[model samples]
Target chain A: MSLDFLAGFTIFMLALIMVVSMVPGLLAGLESSGIDYDAVAYRTGVILVEDPGWPVYPPWEMNDEVHKDEIERIGLAVSKDTPNILLSTKVETFFNDSFFTPDDYRNLAIFGDIPYSYHFSLRSLDGVTYNEETGDPLPPGYGYIRRVVKIKEPGVAVINGTTFAPQYTSLSSNQEFIVRLDFGQLLDPSVGAAYRIDPRTEPVNVTITNFGAYLNMTEPSTNATLRTVTFWKKDPTRPIPQFTRIPFAYGTTDSSLYTLTIDGNPYDLTPDTKVFDNDNISLVLKPAATSLFTLDQNSILDIRFNFGDTPSQTNITGIHHYDYNSTNVTLPDLQTGVLEVAVW
Target chain B: MVNDAGQLYTMEGVAAGVIMLLTVYIVISTTSIYTPGDTHIPDMQLEQLGSDVLAMMDTPDTNGTKSALETFVNADDDAGFESMFLSYCNAKASGAADDLHMSANVTYRDGNLIKEHQFLAPDNTWTGRESAVRVTRWVQLDSQPGRTTYAGARAQAVLVEVLLWRA
Candidate 1:
């Protein structure tokens, strides 16, 4: 009965007179401010944001096999199991066109000296080299032959030990050469960058003072012959991969069997996952993580993740930044469903 | 007795205030239409900007390497990093003559980069809570004749740094 909605109030009347008349100008002003009003509002409107801190790399770095803070060694060691004089081929034996990197080509064009010429030669050519005793055809003038071998045990590595290079005779090429590089050695102590070898105290610090070379195969007889390529790790610091963290997540139902992989091995978590204790649950890694995966620098411990009513799979993400610094393992964030993982 | 001019002045003041109040109300109402979905930039500007700069960096497609840096920035709010690291290499493909102004640095916390600092440079410095990395980015410049250019003078020996750990 009071005149609130119908006749309206005194303030309403005042606004009608002022606001109705000023509407066009207000609209025009609003149209001119070109600001991201939404962003401003959401930013200004928010009360608080939540950030949960999680230790990122514990599971991956927990391996006793890890070799850290010091250099480790890798390569075919000059010991009992180290390969010796395996077969190798010339990778650089070519025809008329030889394209080199700016620095390499520049040195040759200016000084005509190839002290740094990228080439390799045969250390053991018995198979391809025509041994007069066997009366086999001599290695074709401009070609190569190669072979591959695996280490029976872990030790220090050198190229002269396990690898062998096939012989080749120079053909129409202007120059033919082979440059020996210790491609097998993974670490050098002088520079102290760090190298490692696993299966021998996890990883022994070492460096690559020498790297295997690109053997020249340009022979005088074979201008275009069949090519055999066998490439490998130049003296590489080797380590046996070890386990790091065992990531496991579970559901509280009868269907709660989850699978988590640590290193390359798998453990049944039915015992480890289901605990009736009301206290805080901590996952303990077994066998202690070590830097066992040093043999192949690119090698890593594969972790398979499976959890919940659905298929739970997680892959280790790389925790590295520019300047080539990498954590070597990626720890997962449980709240975000990312797990801590490592590569041996 | 109030003079006529004084009365007029008072009226003008009242009118100005009322006008301002009305304008503010209208502005708030108009902007409220945008506060939710946030769909305003022209199609794919963010994506285009991001990919364009990433391509210029010549970062690899693999999970890490330069791609990691790009991915890390993607986690930031769209506008949060727009003027900072996002514009670092916006025009890298446009042969050397383009002028681009950008700087990059690491963000640190507790005396360490929030993310580990990995890219290499000649000189690095850190003092207590604050540090700046010199990320060498591109800047347009006056050209010089007969001089061989490496990555062109468009790039200057500048710096890229960030703040992270505070001890």
Candidate 2:
């Protein structure tokens, strides 16, 4: 009889406690406002803008007829054409990923729903990138249209094409998860929102480590009397094996350094070498140091050579240079497979 | 009143059981979510655009002073080409297009086209873009057409090789 009485009392106490707990929770649930979360679009990208006017390397060909044809090919007017540089490149990057997650599921939900449209406009050449609308300046080049590229986990992400990452989270669904949105608007049907690097956008610091001109400056040679012999060292990261020691891309400044030895004599490169990594090559220059070539009588000579990301990349800087001295300039022996030597 | 409380508790148990069953059914139906499938779109659209770009590979003729490589690039065709290229980028960037690609390699000599060959494009299986071209302001893109998202093969790529020279 005593055991039964104690059990009943214990049950009564438990029931009373449960009722007390439920009262506050029920009231709170009734009064609580549902989650009002920000949308993924607002948190991910800036508002859409018109064409960013990313740069383009004007088409160029050496032949008059071919050049004319190339102009027609790019759909530009011959007389109105400006010197556009092209940087050819053989770049290979694979997007390899093994992990898929809840966020990926969310993309299936979000990306399909949002209606995205792209617009672009021209920017001034002085690197003044303006938003096509309102005429406001964009973040130097392409601004952050999206916050995250590929989402790795909740509230964290990776930048596409680049390794850098920024803090990000999805405001939609209020789930406090990572957001993945790509805002890199492609060039017009043929271009991307970001700069369109053809053979033109290469580092211009490429030097002819071993370039010797067989001119009247020293002694007349079978090579062009006013002939310029210049050799550019292939960058370690050159895109093509046929061009560089290593078939890969090197850092901008380091690879741009061109070690040029004129007849075994090294010469630091000057801007006038008409050396820009691009598809088109045409420029006249005044020599900085006339070690192997004399600039007195035939001071001006048209020189054309291209050094870039083996396949493409012209605006690159710090190509290898050569050692220039008072005495005879010597050049290192390079495979002259593409070079055709002749004198006028 | 005692009987009423017993029945209330029983109702909650039944409701929870139904929810559990529903959750299992939903998961089974959505399992195909992670696996990607093809859109299988036709090739006519891509081919037309490809031909137009290649056909415009016009350049200037031989002048002792001009670089044949530079001269061969089209002049008036630039705006049109850029428009096309920009649109391509936009479509891919916007994820409205698929990531199909193609390209070609060429060697320039004596202001003339010499050796030319078709190139493989970047794929999910590869690390880098094959037959890619680096342009100004646009960085570099693969020579082959780029990719856009699709449930299946909504896009296709046609390989082409053209030796651009003055006509």
Residue B39 in model 2: shift from native, Å?
4.8
Off by over 4 Å in 1: A1-344, B1-52, B61-136, B139-167
| Residue B84 lDDT in candidate 1 | 29
CA lDDT scores, all candidates in order: 0.25, 0.23
List per-candidate RMSD values in Å: 28.0, 26.0
User: Chain A TM-score for each candidate, in the given order?
Assistant: 0.16, 0.19
Write down the C-alpha DockQ for each prediction: 0.04, 0.03
DockQ of 2: 0.03
Ten contiguous residues with the weakest lDDT in model 1 chain A: A334-343
The positional error of residue A239 in candidate 1, measured at the CA in angstroms, is: 20
Provide TM-scores for the models: 0.20, 0.20
TM-score of chain B of 2: 0.24
lDDT of 1 at A256: 16
- Model 1 global lDDT (CA atoms, 0 to 1): 0.25
